[model samples]
Target: MSDTPLLDQLESGPWPSFVKDLKRVAARKPAAKDLLKQLDRSYKDKITHWKHGGIVGVLGYGSGIIGRYSDLPDEFPGVEHFHTIRVNQPSGWFYTTQALRDLCDIWDRHGSSILNVHGSTGDMIFLGTTTDELEPTFAELTAKGWDLGGSGSAMRTPSCCVGKARCEYSCYDTMDFCYEMTQEFQFDMHRPSFPYKFKIKCSGCPNDCVAAVARADLSVIGVWKDDIRIDQAAVAAYHAGEIKPRGGGSPYAKLDVKADVTDLCPTACMSFDGKKLAIDNKNCNHCMHCISLMPQALRVGTDTGATLLLGSHAPILEGAQMSWVIVPFTEMEPPYDNIKELIANIHEWWSENGKNRERVGELMLRLGMRNFFKSVGLEPPSQTVRTPRANPFFFWHAEDFEAEAAGRKYIKI
Candidate 1:
């Protein structure tokens, strides 16, 4: 592993990767070095499939990742198995030196040396672990005050911004909520009782560093119902290009950066009254478009929390859709019962009727919003599920209107 050319190739890049991290272990462990070489060679040979085992469980009450590899004998080597394990991370990512070293020590003892600190998805992914080592490794991890995260078809590990715990922009306690939700959905996570995977994401403010938009099956984003707090000093700094906005969304549109703010302001929220920034609450979408570009000047107010959105399906199911705010904005309570119940209801409904490969959003579409609401016992809100496929093309009103409209239409037949 010490002499592996791939390690040198990887080290030349911008930053370190899991492969590079594993090289440290590879230096001492011949098995790790052999594994890396095998992987490198496999890539060169265009090896596609990796095979492994089943019934893998993690330690404690609620922690572990379970996977089933594609059992195509002709396509894969007998030793190559495609499986991942979830190592629970420290809250707020505040890791002690001792704790960190202890974790690596245990991994060396039981599983593979490679560690994915965090890729786009939130879990601390451990690649290439055997099925037999699963339970014992989990036991050791939990014994050392760590557990597992979501893997397989279960609900994925929920993540949040480094909230009030670290970040100043945090309006709500995002960390507590993330941990609470993890505990709340333990059964749903450890047990594969759903049609497909579920994911949840929370952020301190609109500055969604976690990429909740594309990743989560359900997104809980923070917003303020009140006006943007204008810090004149901060705005001046931003206009001078000394500061940047904290939230996600259209950044250039805010702080009159586009130069069109003097004309038809996109949100009509910003108007320059002789070098002074004015915000109109009614037209604002709470997108933080302005706040982002001019961070010092525009800040989300104290009277703020989160909005729940749905319709996030992976590429396999369909393109991700933005779900409407069913429960518009709720207080971030300790237990988070309201949000938990809503999530549970959705899971229950999906589990009962969804086909093997069907996504929650697809199921909602197929069953109709009216029926979905009825079954869930949720009152239909203003935002109905957008029926992309079901539309006027296949819809007819009553008996005569369709025929009359068709007859009146200019047809060459």
Candidate 2:
């Protein structure tokens, strides 16, 4: 009974998809039914009827509503006043089953029973609500310990991986840090007073389980300053029990390290004799690949900290960019004022000079790193390495060069 034969096949897959759920909802809800019909029409015509609603928000709030409107209002009256609500997610996305059920119940009562678990900015996306219900819905949700996430030009929800709580590889408390930041920046999160939406994401370690390094405006990645802890006995046990050689003449067999942990080190910082393994602490990048392979044999270093990367974003005005190392290391401890100061400085600088709707990464691209560093009052460190450094020429400030020439050391901030 549907023209979308190929789209229907998507419902038959082993995994459950939102499409199937939407279709099911469509069977009961008139708005959902119209939405499906409109979507189908849009697909066939290669166009959409939805348009952005200018300056839409809840009472006393200037951000957090992406307005959805149907141009074919007469044909799809049910979808005429549809809007999306982005609710800030809990740190590490850890929600009790009861909490989720309660949230679903709330949405079912106030709006269409459609939801997106996590939006691109790490918010719990509640789809399909009218303008009239917005304030009441927000009030009820706030009463129940829920808050709206950021939209337009404001600090978005800070997301993090489940560190220390579950993963042994975690070098820091990512969830706690994320929660701290969310609470501390409440004013910034609720207000739309920035050049563009800013996102912060935390990873337990450089494994980047949440893809923070590639997508976040500011990325906090856990790291260690000292050598990885290794248990020689456990290493030997693992080697004896799990390490095996491929008998057949396979290409991979020739290059396999077998149980030798030294050969598995991508940086070649490790060396193994017949009985023991030695690692060059200075050379280890803390990739955790070797540790992942032999978890029982090795652990993270004692002096744990975080590496801050900046200016990562998806394709927009300037294009997609992977965040670059800004602060190579910062001690992540209680009352993280240093990180807060750094965030404030970055935001202030960007808000002053950035164009409307321009992301931090785009501004960085437009204005060189040197200018950004100067504005933020940070000296370019030796560790700073930009991607695609094809043309090796770099501009040095005359004052800095003179100071260096005079044998006066420039202190890094």
User: Ten consecutive residues with minimal summed lDDT in candidate 1?
Assistant: 73-82
Off by over 4 Å in 1: 1-24, 58-63, 67-83, 240-266, 383-413
The residue-by-residue lDDT of candidate 2 on 247-359, one tens digit each, is: 22223322223444567777898876646767898999888776766666778898998999898988754467889888888899978998998899999999999999888
Per residue, candidate 1 scores C-alpha lDDT tens digits across 129-172 of 56677777778887987767766567877887788887666768
Which candidate number maximizes TM-score?
2
Candidate 2: regions farther than 4 A off: 2-6, 12-17, 242-261, 316-318, 387-396, 401-406, 409-413
